[model samples]
Target: MKIVVLNGSPDSRRFELDCYLAELEGLLETRGHVVKSFELRAMNIGHCTGCWGCWVKTPGECVIRDDSQKVCRAAINSDLLLFASPVIMGFTSAVLKKISDRLIPLLHPYFEIDRGEIHHRKRYERYPAVGLLLERATDTDEEDLELIRDIYARMALDFKSELKFTGLTGNPAEEAADALDRL
Candidate 1:
């Protein structure tokens, strides 16, 4: 399986998170799986302008010409995508949200009825399954985590993918890998 990780922590010196990701990468690689990761905070990704250029003018590609294209491409190509971010104000980091918003180009503009609701048409043949790896905030609670999970579950639906699991940074990397390995 090919996996891609989107790291959205803004701190440059994220020692524990960095080490955890490295461990996860190594575990996957040793199992003969390809793994790729992007530190979104360090990348030059711009916020989506909501112009619909990608859907209309560009046809399945963003016109911004930034690092987000690479992220989107990798994500679309992967079998699993793990979004790793620290909770900020009860949500994922803004950097992750920025790049995530940029992923709109991956879907078609036309809407289709899915599960009795309007949804964008899928542009690609396949999209990656998703997982969440979050570092809880100081004041985080169970309700906050549940809200985050529900939000990402909706995102998975929009992307035409499944959300496998949502784990926490406090968990050992081996445990997270084990959960993914089962999938």
Candidate 2:
């Protein structure tokens, strides 16, 4: 499987997270999966303009020519998408949200009639399974976990992908790797 991990924490190379991700990458490689990682802090990704250009004017492309297009391409090419972030204010980091906003072009604009009922179209070509890793300090870990789960649930609905596994309050990278291994 080709896995694309997005490190959305502002602290791209933060010690614990980095170590975890490294371990996870090695484990995945050992399991015959290629991993590609994107650190949001290192990329010059602009906020989404909500221009709907990708849907209206251009198809499957964004107007803002930046790191987002690369990220989206990676997402499209990957079999699994891992979203790793440090909990901020009981939610995902703003960096993740920004990337997600730019990814709006990947989703359908309105509803599709699957069996006579209106439903959003599946966003990805294969509906790549998602793994969420939420890192936080000791006391607030549980709360942050719940908040993160809720956030991802909403995201899953929007993206029409399944939230396969969630790792919270543990070593970010290792826990995430373990979750992926279970998949």
Candidate 3:
């Protein structure tokens, strides 16, 4: 399988989340899967303007000539998308949210009464599985994990992918290694 791992943490290689992703990458590679990792922090990604230019003006092309479109292309070609991030206030990092927002161009838009709603019905077929790694602080509340699970659930529904969550609280390295083994 060709896998694309998106590191949502802004700290890139310095963050604990990277340890998790690295372990997973090694596991996948050992299993004869080609892995390509993208760190959201290092890429020059811009915020989505909600212009719908990608859908209306140039189909499948984003107006923003940034690294995000490149990531989107990789995602389209990948067999699995591994999304990793550090839990921040019971949610994904801002970097991941920005990436997700910019990915709006990958979705279809339907207009109704001058309002456009994104239709992601076709996006699911490209990638059937998603592996999520979340690193929570030691002091983080259990409710935070619940909130993260809820968010992942919604993401799974939208992408039509089987969402697997590996929660690494405090001991990211060990937990990540175990998670990779389980995967």
Model 2, 1-183: lDDT tens per residue?
889989887874467666677778888898888999998889999998889888778877888899999999888778788898777777778998899889877876767875465667765666667878767755565666887788786677667677888875464555556668768
For residue 37, give model 3's deviation from the true position in Å: 0.3
TM-score, candidate number 1: 0.97
The prediction achieving the highest lDDT against the true structure is: 1
For residue 169, model 2's alpha carbon misses the true position, in angstroms, by 5.5
Per-residue CA lDDT of candidate 3, range 70-147, in tens?
898888787667677887777878998898787666555652221244435553346536667777765568888777
lDDT of 1 by residue, 112-164 (tens): 99999888889999999999999888899999999999999999999988899
Judging by lDDT, tell me the better candidate of 2 and 3.
Answer: 2
**Candidate 3 TM-score versus the reference:** 0.80
TM for every model, in the order presented, reads 0.97, 0.87, 0.80
Clashing residue pairs, candidate 3? none
What residue runs in model 1 are displaced by over 4 Å at the alpha carbon?
Answer: none
Cα error, candidate 3, residue 76 (Å): 1.9
